[model samples]
Target: MKVIHLHQEEKKIIEEAVVQNRQAQHKLYVKYAPKMLSVCRQYIKDLQQAEDVMITAFMKVFVNLKYFEHKGSFEGWIRKIMIHECISYLRVKKEMKFVEDEEFTHEMHNNIESQFSVEAIQFLIDALPDGYKMVFNLYVIEGYKHHEIAEMLGISPGTSKSQLSRAREVLQTQINSLNKFNHGTI
Candidate 1:
């Protein structure tokens, strides 16, 4: 499955699939499942729930493929669907709570100085509380605005900003502790 080769012709295949080509549709699913699963996992936090969300999102994408105008990147469009589906799953779970800290600010400048390895940072992100993780992923990783995150997660923009601030603060603290512990060992 050379996606790069199909990138140019995917619109035609998708259009055909929209009309009636089960094989083309299946090919599209196979092509997108892994990436979509990753997207789903960021929001749901449970492997099974993520898989279920990916399946539901793919179904919606295929069913609604006719609405696609090829005006933008197909991958981006599908990614949006996965994001929406994950948010919908989260909403149904009613886990959209936000941390409130009036004094919290995005002042974790030390963590961004390239001192922490990618694996270390990723581990810290994975360990974040659910609310923080969701906000961080939406705002930082996915390039969404705090207002968009607020609407997606049903929280206020202040809450989204607060969660991101708290997440960064936690990551900074963890990194500092890790550095201190490592230094003491040396």
Candidate 2:
């Protein structure tokens, strides 16, 4: 039940820990773990796996803490590590295999807007089939280009685009359905 106050003393303790004080290091981990765990949970579907990933990611963060200049937020640095860990975990899991199908090339639509509730959008994302979810997460949420997604997932750029398009269509359909339901109920 520790309150995370980013006061001068807290920052000084973290800086001291980065300079090799074991107690401050432990305190830093205790202070940051809850926040970092929440970030890990968003990227990973399973709770236990999220905890494992966070643990490993924090270890890496602690090891590299000395390299952290005050250039960015400390939380942002930890977030990047957690994200990389999640990517590695997903890559190893191979939950969805990426296939290159030339017939499924996607043409991007312009200026699409969504006014759905956050819960509705999350529901749609969670409902997506595994392959579509992975590609959508990487390309849309993570801001990865199709070529990079193709390289990372062993799929063709066309397939990456197609998957993203399909994911969007599915999401839009979900939103429409939810909107209809809302209108009907009201």
Candidate 3:
């Protein structure tokens, strides 16, 4: 079944939400909550905690709806908010200690997407130290520049690059190990 385009309706809902219309707010929440939760889960490994962050972010979104100009996708705007909320949650929940390495070689993990399930990849990411995971997700998943990540996470761009390099190395090692074990070579 083809779903009708939501942009026109979303604009109307967004306007109503700006005025604090409860039903419009509820509709927006129902439409966005699932995707927002997934965005939260990318940063937060715990589903329940991700949900909490998503809810908090949604509240902020509704509160700040008036500031949302029609220049971009509402989903993207919400996602940015969700990412910030996750960062805040992580900050309060755990300290992210970034390692400063300016010269680590970048290692790419190739051809694993076909072999690894999304959950498996997420598990590997979840295993990373908080700082590495945050940089890796921002750089790799969310396509943020290192400088942007550094600014957002309050670290140097060099530190962000280093964290990404280290994260790639660790994930590559783990995936290689998994490949060997699965192929009975280890």
Model 1 pairs whose backbones collide = none
> Among these predicted structures, which one has the highest lDDT?
3
User: Per-residue lDDT of 1-186 in model 2, one digit per residue for the tens?
Assistant: 244455567778879888889899899889889988876765676779989999999889888988887676777788778777877887788766555566663555655466777655666787887678778877776687989978876788889888888887887767767777867963
Off by over 4 Å in 3: 1-5, 107-113
Clashes of 2: 0
TM-score of candidate 3 against the unseen true structure? 0.92
Model 2 misplaced regions, further than 4 Å: 1-14, 19-23, 26-35, 103-117
> lDDT by residue for model 3 over 1-186, one digit each (tens)?
223456777898999999999999999999999999989998998899899889999999999999999888889999999999999999887757888777766655566554888898899999999999999999999999988998999889888988998898899889889989988999
In Å, residue 119's CA in model 2 sits off its true spot by: 4.0
Rank order (by TM-score, best first): 3, 1, 2
Return the number of clashes found in candidate 1. Answer: 0
TM-score of each prediction: 0.84, 0.71, 0.92
Candidate 3 residue pairs in clash (backbone atoms < 3 Å): none
Candidate 1 lDDT tens digits, 64-118: 9999998888889999999998877877887656766555575455634556776
